[model samples]
Target: MAQVHLLANRKGGVGKSLISLNMGAVCADTAGARPDGRPSVAVASADPQGTSLWRAARLADQPFDVLDISGDVANVALLKSLPYDHIWVDTPGWAEITPEEYAAGKDPLGDEKYGTLLSALLDQADDVVVPILTEPDSFEPTWQTIEWVLKPRNVPFVVVINNWPPAEGIAYVEGTRAFCEGHGWPVARTVIRRYRVHTNATKVVTQYHNNRVELQAREDFFRFALEHGMRTAAAKEVVS
Candidate 1:
């Protein structure tokens, strides 16, 4: 059975899609093939925007299969039947559904019109990756998602500080790390710095293995993966 990993955060602009695409590609590249010789990794896009799907389409040859499991609760069930070792889900940024909206019969999954689809996806996820920026506004939603959703479900998760500023932002990063640690949340030791390469990565088919300009970003991701136990499956073979 495939382990489903969700890249989720209620706040936008936190590098969720970027992390999802790269992590999914890396998982596909590193995963051992199935007994039938088929690749053992795939990605599912639950985001209504379809950004990950668009990027996958742009690639001449994708590292792994990409499924646009958007809009319907049935799609989430469909993903469970796929034969893959690892399935990464790229979820939308809006995760919080206000009581007023719920009472008004408005869905939090947005205009996609899929009621409770996000909840269904979360139910299927084995693990969740939360990308957070080191700012007050971003931190608020990230914390809420963790406290209200993940914690309640007893799901394992790691908070990754993405697009961190360089030297000048060191203090802010430290503060954020301390805050998470104090709250008993698992925060990745690896911090991804702001880089031009990451910003422009969506324009082309790129992964950590093929990226040249921002090698550190790739390194950071690798470290994060290692910390999260994702490297234990085939780390040596993947690195070699």
Candidate 2:
């Protein structure tokens, strides 16, 4: 069975797609870094927008399978039976709904138009990698996201602070930690700083290690992905 890592959030623009692509690729690129040769990786996009799928198409060489399972129930139900070691799912932050439905009150997880797909993916997830910015607006949705989707299911997760500007985010980063600690949120030590290379990635991070800036760009995800992989393994062991 593949160990699935879902990059999820209730707020968009938190770097879910970017993390999906990099995390999956990083796990794939490391190949023999793990004892079992790390095997295969598949990134499935569960969002209706398919941002990850669209962006992955532009990569010169795809290191892993990118499945568009936005509305594919059969495939999602069978994800665990797939032959990959890891499968990263990029989920939607926003749901599709009519104005009437919106007025009625939206589902924090999703709406009828996209709810089923999200539910299926969530069911198969071994763990969720929740990305969020340090800004105040990103906090509430993140809290709602974990409380609504993860806690009920008892899914283990790591809250990764993304898009951090290293130059001036020291206090903000520390404050995020304080905030997470106050609320008992499981947070990743890694902070993915904003980078031009990330905003315009054409290849996997490993492919850009020749340059200093690029290495730094890949460093953040490398650490976080490794941490995530270890957590997945540990979680499975406990389950066993």
Candidate 3:
């Protein structure tokens, strides 16, 4: 059976789609592991932003398909029917934050749709990966979303630190770690450093194209996935 991975976080601007595309490539491009000659990977854009669709059109040569998922039950059912090795979903950030914004509440997930969507999404996902920014502003929503997902669902997830600029200093990074540890969230050991190349490449619909710095970041992410018992090259090695 194919594994389903959802790139989800209620926090916007957390680099969710970019990570979805790159990680999908990592699965599709596993060296020497395509002998089964199957369509091994795909990305689903559950957001209205269509980030994955634009990226797919730009690359044109990516090995997997890009799908769109509205809230429609039919589309969701079709996705569940597909035979794929890795189905990755990029969900809208803070699908539940609209109500919070309206209420002037500090809780970001105050909207009800967020809860509905999150419940449906988690029901289909084997694992959820939450990408978080290290600053104070991004931290609360990260925890809020985590708490929401874990209740009565037991959805397994990991928190990844994104946009981590070295110049931001270790103090902020350490603080983020302390917060996660205090709450018992799994923080990926590999921190994806902020890089100019990541920003530049995203401008042109570049999929799976990385410079040295971004490539290093990709490796770090892969290591985290490996350590967490998620699929990686090591799993492919068995098939190879």
Candidate 4:
């Protein structure tokens, strides 16, 4: 069965699509071809926006396949049985936060259509990656995603701090880390730093011209991938 990695956050505008594309590419490229000739990795977009699918379409060649499972009940049903070693899902932003919803203790995924598709895909998620910015405003939603959704359902996840700048975001980086620590949440040791190369990236980092900047960008993901892999392996070992 393919290990489905869900890149999700209650709030949008994070690096979910970018991570879904490049991280899958890195793992696919590194793992090389499967013996059965199937693609080693794929990215499935559950986001209504189709950011990952649209970006993959623009690429002349993709290391991994991209699937548009948005609003597709059939596709989501057979997601786990797909012939890939790994699958990354870019989930849509959740429904708007309303006082009534909170008071009622209801956590909605989105509108009816979106909620249905998201619920189906999320059911098969083997792993979840929650990305957040350094700003304090992103914290409450992150907490809601963790507390109301993931924790209640017993979903395995990691909170990764995305788009950090070496000089500009140093303090905020620490603040974010501290926040995660206070909550006793698991945060990746790797910090995905901000660069024009990432926010404006059109192609996979490996597909870039292979310059120093691109190499650095790829390394950041590689490090995180390594850490993520180890954590996943450890979890499996414990389960076994």
Candidate 5:
């Protein structure tokens, strides 16, 4: 079965794009890096900004290819026809959008365009991964999304806390933990602490905040992949 991972969040500035491309790069590396005969791994970018495409271009030397999911009538049809080992979906930030505006822009569902993309993704996916920010305002929207995705959809998903600041006081992290635990959210054991490296790193380049390469950040992501059982050590070959 194909592994469809959605790098989604209802709110923007939550690092959805960063996680999506990183996950796609990792998955592509895991699948042996080549596009042909190799396991297919593509990023179905639904954002107008084309952040994923830019990132993919930056890493064009890598084995895999990044396909743009242009806002065409055939977009969904094309996605449905793809045969890949994993499809990493970079969804739009829609919590700030009005309901009507979002619905008009989506597929059949009364959601964002990414919602239509999500519908197609869920059809082919066995798992979905959501990135949630630790801020309180963002937390409510994240949960709202969880409720929506869970309704009548049996696809399994896990939530990762992004942009986590260590000096934000213990109450913040504890609050997030308690909220996830109380609401049955599958929070990952390793929290991605807010590092300058993470903030400074671009899509293709490996620069970090402290003027160093953040290999540890990549390792943390590898661990996430392992815990989720999405990929194993074999996938690491694509990175080199």
Candidate 6:
């Protein structure tokens, strides 16, 4: 069975899709062929916007299979049967409705369809990756999702600070890390810095390890995957 990873956060514009694609690329690139000769990595997008699917389509040669399983009960069910080592699911940018809300029919997100799909994904996921921005505005919703949704389900998770500005100095980065640690949250030591390479990723088929200029970004993501248990021993051996 594939280990399902959900890239999720209630906060919008937190780089969830970007991180999902990059990590999927890394898994596809490093994991090699499976015992059955199937691809090692696959990506399933549950986002209504289908951004990941669109990006995958634009690539000249897709490294791995990308599936648009948004709001489809049958497609979501098909995830368990996929013959891959790692399966990454990209979820929408809203917090899932609580059971209380669902029972009460409050439907805070305005649709039971989305909440149901998200709930199913969370239930099936082996690990969750919460991408958060460095700004103060992103802090509240990030913690809220972790506390209200992920923690309640006892899901294992790690917070990655995305789009960190290089000029902000070590003090800013350390402060964010300290804050998360103080709250007893696991935070990735590797911070993905702001770069044009990442911003332009959607328009091209560049992997993190492809260009010399993207070496730092590549290392950051590679370390993040290793620390978060996303990479296999064989992948780590190749990196080392």
Best by TM-score: 4
Query: 105-178, model 6: which lDDT tens digit per residue?
Result: 56444456887788778888877888887788888778767877788788778888888988888777787777
Work out the TM-score per prediction: 0.82, 0.88, 0.78, 0.94, 0.76, 0.84
Across 194-218, the per-residue lDDT of candidate 2 in tens digits comes to 8888877687676665678988988
RMSD of candidates 1 onward, in order: 5.3, 3.7, 5.4, 1.7, 6.3, 4.9
**After superposition, candidate 2 runs with Cα above 4 Å error:** 32-39, 95-107
What Cα-based lDDT does every candidate model obtain?
Answer: 0.75, 0.82, 0.69, 0.84, 0.64, 0.77
Encode model 4's per-residue lDDT on 1-240: one tens digit a residue: 888999988888878998888889888987877897767899888888888888888788888988888878767878889888899899888766665786687655655887777677778988899998898888988888887778878889999999887878488999999999899889999999887877664678778767888888778888989999999999899889
Q: Would you list the rank order by TM-score, best first? A: 4, 2, 6, 1, 3, 5
Residue 179 lDDT, candidate 5, scale 0-100: 87
Model 6 is weakest, by summed lDDT over 10 consecutive residues, at 201-210
| Global Cα lDDT for candidate 5 | 0.64
Of candidates 6 and 5, the better by lDDT: 6
**Can you give the lDDT of residue 179 in candidate 4?**
97
**Could you say which candidate leads in lDDT?**
4
Report the lDDT tens digits of candidate 5 across residue range 120-234: 6566555567777778888877775676554447656778877778788767777887888798877777676665655443442222223333665666666776676633232
Model 3 C-alpha lDDT per residue in residues 132-215, reported as the tens digit of each score: 888888887787678755544677678888778988798888999889989988887777777665555443222434666556
The 10-residue segment with the lowest total lDDT in model 1? 201-210
* Model 6 misplacement above 4 A: 35-38, 95-111, 202-211, 230-240
